[model samples]
Target: MDHLINHPGILTAFSVIIFIMLLLDLGVFNKKSHVVSNREALIWSVVWISLAMGFSGVIYYFMGLEQFTQFQSAYWIEKALSVDNLFVFILVFGFFNVPKEHHHKVLFWGIIGALVFRAIFIFTGVELINMTYLPEMDLFGHAARINVVLSIFGIFLIVAGIKSWFAEDGDDGDKDFTKSPGARLVHRFFKVSKNYDGDKFFTIENGIKMATPLLVVVAVIEFTDLIFAVDSIPAIFAIAPDDPFILYTSNIFAILGLRALYFLLANFMYMFSRLKYGLAVILSFIGVKMLISPFFHISSPVSLLIVGGILILSVAASLLFPVKE
Candidate 1:
């Protein structure tokens, strides 16, 4: 913590490194925007996700499993939450009639926005916690307590889950979904082009067509994740709250793979209708846990096990009970 804080320049350097790497990813690896074939998407997806997990091994070897446990829990949880985001993406994409060819571009920009948000949230969260000098994480002047903020997050997810469960279920369970604040605000503040003209986000209707409905989908994708920060950030703070480096780096990398994950799983998304219910349970459970965590002594490792177990079982169950049947 002290080393990272003292050498704050490392964070900037890290961002620059990520940028250069992204340049390489797009420029060398995927210069021409080809339809992300399953084989290609899978390869890149595996490479990135494996790298993230490998980083977790590094954390475990150095800081211990408790810390590694926290990262795994956060990474898995965020990945799952992003699944919900995908449900929304499918909706927004369908609504806008975005072309398959242009989908990658939209996702690319949307992911860039997510990276920016994570950087800010993790940095500010750590700085604020440090400044407080609260022996533990005390909001005001007391020991860290799961105050109303946490309860609200818990209840909000519960309600969101129930709403998702019952909301007008479209083909295979893609409901009208938008949990991202940015998406909502943009939808409210700006007028959207209703029809998609090829890959354009905006069209002049007579002659010229701009980026079109595609850009809106991308923006909505970006915004859809705001509420995610609300849930996962606190969840992470629950584990190794002081290590800002772990929190931010793990989150940044996990998200870096999301676009690839999306393309990789795009068509098969319909098979996982049961996943929403599972994620709802997980989110609601975590929210409640975060709310009550202050009262009880739930160790990070235990928290990790419960979360990981839930994810594995949920996946197994979803596969066992397919939506087609």
Candidate 2:
């Protein structure tokens, strides 16, 4: 497979688009911390999704159909898996009693952290995968090279899928987020104030500068995304394990849109009550794909169709079978 990174023009285009969007997102549109309305969230969601699809078109133009489908598959997988992250974000905000106005700021910073961490995970994972390919040998009459890392990741994702399938609702709702390692890491390093001071992450109380609950919230969010990546990153690896460029670009585009998505869906949680089941199937399907890659290749187009179909069905089921309030 040809690596997208080899195309300098495409790389430049991807970088420029991301840079400009983020600049507009933080430096311009959201310059002030204010309550984001549903309309605004909807508009931004459309903008981001359109940008992602447009960029995928660019990929198809330059990298051909295979890479385009790879991008689509990875992008949707990350987007689907990330719904679970939004659920946690809601709980975290509620736990901290975070003011409605500050949710975007928290999610923005959380995504920035994700952009960096995901690059590290995807690139490092690709190199590890390259190193772990077993010597080719006959396995049931066909010679194939199996990657040890991908095999382990496959098993892990399958287990994660099963766990997600049977997972109970409100599992994290009643837990104390203050006990989270993310919060503890913040408390160990800085004196945290008892109250918030506007949208500031730091506050001065009694002539002492201290971290506010808002900062603790960001830390928790960052740590939460890192943990979520354990599943999400590996799932994407099942799509384009050898092409870090495809993996990272698609993973980032999906993540960049999540803040808007969170706001848009925050009030419509019941509409996706059945999404976990769909995500479980997607994860297990990707895991099985990875496990079988040595014996049979699943074309990216088929993978894209399956993933898109599952997502559509999940949302339709959620609407039709509407979870009783």
Candidate 3:
């Protein structure tokens, strides 16, 4: 529960670094819109992973082993949960028929919005937990103050994980943008074009400023990320409930590389057919851990090993026994 790196200097430094990296990524490297090649995606994916791992080393050097373990646990959990987000991204892009060349544009803006929103969610969650009653209770065979807010997060995760496990895949059902309340509200208030005007989200047509289909797709993508964050944010909270720095940094690092990860895995999504079950088990385990944390303390290393093992086994199983068409 010790916040070793909760200093203004550290926070400010990380914020600046993240801002500069984002500028370099979007402004310099990906300034043009084109289909992201496998090689490019693979290379960037490694870059992002290496950056995250390197940050863990920095944490270990400055904060010691305990904090480093917490960061690793949070990072792995967030990264694993993000795979589900990538799957949904494929669905969203396909649903809108977003051109391959424009996909990065939408995702770039989507990630920007996500970073802002997730920061809000992280700070808000920490404040709410701090406001709750802190009663010394026996948790995990140790005397610790039980957090009502965290327990609620645990319950939500358990429910969500169960629901996700039983949920059917490839079932878009009857949902459409026209049926979406947000889409309808936007359409009512703005002038919308039926077709895309290149990759522009806005264009001047007949002397009137209008929104393009691309704008709609971006809106949908942003909204979808917000929905996904509902689950992912809490999952990370379960990993590092006491340290907002660990939680936020891990979440942001996992998300920053998602565009490349999306490109790498989008074509091979079907190969990981059992990933949902693994995710379900992981979420459920974390939820149980949170709930029982008052009575049984599970160390961060144990958590990391278990989560990594589940994901690895699920992926291996999927590859060994491919789903039949």
Candidate 4:
């Protein structure tokens, strides 16, 4: 942690490599079409996710065992949370009727924005956690604060999970990011078009100008990301204990994979109906763990086990009980 915080080379290198990759992805690979195929998406997904894990290993080898553990825990929590974003992305694309090839472009921009916003968030969060220290002996009080916050998150997940579980029944739930508090404010002030023009976000058609549904999809993607940020950020804290490097690296890697993940998993999303249950359980568990972290001091090993177990169980359940078309 000390090494990473002090040495600035890591951030610079990470940015240069990631940006270059995106250029290749958009400018080279996904240069055409808006709709992506599951196979192509999965290949890209594997490439990036493998890269991320490999990067984590490098950090571990260079930094130390301790930092690596922190990174892994944070990574696991974030990876799980990202699955929720899958459903949200599906909704955004469905509502906007975004073409497959164009989805990559949207996510390309999204990754850029998300990484920037999250950097600010990580820096601020790390500073606060470091500066503020509660009485060590008053484990009771410390635990209580942790519990209160975690419980709130847990409750949020429980509700979200329940909503997701029933979502298949045609309940729209709170799935629309465009209707979020901030997005709503933006919409009220901006004059927007009523329909789409393929990949074009804004254009003049005949005598009138219009904003494409693609633009709306982009808006929904960004807003939904922020909401996801809220849940994911807290979840990571449960594991890595607010180490900025671990938090940031884990988050960025998971986010970096999202575009590819979406492409790969889009078609098979229904197959993972049990994933909702897995995510729900994971979220609810993390919320509980966070709420009681101080009281219980749950070992990282235990955290790892629970997280892994839930994931396996969920995947198994999904395989066993796929949503039939």
- Most accurate candidate by lDDT: 2
Inter-residue clash pairs, candidate 3: 139-294, 139-295, 140-294, 140-295, 140-296, 141-295
Q: What C-alpha lDDT do the candidate models reach, one value each?
A: 0.68, 0.93, 0.82, 0.70
lDDT of 4 by residue, 1-325 (tens): 3456654676676777787887888789877755667777788888887878787787777777666666776777777778777777877777656666688777877678898888887777656555554545565455333334445555676566566556563344445656655445445645466665666767686766655556666666777788788777866766765567778877888888888777666766765667777777777777677666667767666777788888888878888888665
Task: Decide which is better by lDDT, 1 or 4.
Answer: 4
lDDT, residue 2, candidate 3: 57
Clashing pairs for model 2 are none
RMSD of each: 4.8, 0.8, 2.1, 3.5
Residue 173's C-alpha lDDT in candidate 3?
35
Q: Mind giving the per-residue lDDT tens digits that candidate 3 earns over 1-325?
A: 5574556666676688788988888889888788999999999889888988888887878777777888888888788788887877787778778899899888888889999999999889988887874879765567887779878988999998898899887665335755455456667878998878888988888899999878777777788788888988888777777688888888898889899989988878766888888899988998888887777788887888898899898889778887676
Misplaced by over 4 Å in model 2 are none
Model 1, 189-283: lDDT tens digits are: 55555666665556675554433456556766776667557756665555555777767777877778887788866867655667777776776
Model 4's alpha-carbon lDDT is 0.70
Cand. 4 TM to true fold = 0.83
Cα displacement (Å) at residue 111, model 4: 2.8
- State how far residue 2 of model 3 sits from its true place (Å): 4.2
Pairing residues by index, what is the TM-score of model 3?
0.93
